[model samples]
Target: MLNMKSRYAMRALLYLAGRYGDGPVQIGEIADSQRIPRKFLTVILSELSREGIIGTKRGRAGGYWLEREPSAISYGDIVRITRGSLALVPCAARLAYEPCDNCVPESECHLRLVMLAVRDATADVLDRLTLADPLPGQVELQPERQAAPAQ
Candidate 1:
């Protein structure tokens, strides 16, 4: 249940990653190519720049570029920046933890245990996915093969 802002941030980062080391890319071009509204991208880019995730240049060739190599930037980095928290529920959150209203003791709560497991799994997956990874289009979605019937 990723929010729209997080989705947009990822898209923008992916666009930059695909064009990394090519010099700065125009903000308008990024917006057009990614189908993100220019005004919104402006705000997101500004935030990213402030966070040191991206660098901006000024002048005729001025635009935006990644401050570090794409491989150095993980999905978790972007998610954390854009969404503020990776957990779906406040109780599951590590940085923004707030016990659920109904739960008296989060430490022993079965629901919290399940949610924490989910949060860890999700974080692990995202942390491993770097911006320098192959583009989505390059990934071949192989259909599942049918298994032979047991003898």
Candidate 2:
């Protein structure tokens, strides 16, 4: 399950991406448009700023903007930054891997094996997709048609 912070961050980033070259977007506008809390968004944006994912300005006209082009940032990078690991479990994590405590040895652990596969598959999809990609809900899909019955 995705955490609220990650969800909010993605929303904020997407909103920023839409306004990429238009200049900084005010926090209140983003919050009201995306339905995220102002305080929470402030914290998230600050963390992203420190991570170099975003840039901020200060003044009467100051606000936030992306540091890099949206296409340069991948969903995987965002997930890793916010969630620490794409792996469903710690034992399956690549950068943050840890042996399961008081459990079967790694080589023989089926759970770990399954999780490894899951992590890789998840990474494959997320890494290939950038923030510039159209979000799932944003795209329209054709509805399936019914098949005729055989005589």
lDDT of 2 by residue, 30-148 (tens): 99999999999999999899999999998879999999999998888888888889998889888998877898888889998898899999999989988788766787455898899
Worst 10 residues of 2 by lDDT: 134-143
How well does each candidate superpose onto the true structure, as a TM-score? Answer: 0.84, 0.86
- Which digits, one per residue and each the tens of the lDDT, describe model 1 over residues 76-129? 999899898889889999998887887768767888888889999999989998
Q: Which regions of candidate 1 fall more than 4 Å away from where they truly are?
A: 102-104, 135-151
In TM-score terms, candidate 1 sits at 0.84
Off by over 4 Å in 2: 136-151
Least accurate stretch of 10 residues (summed lDDT) in model 1?
A: 133-142
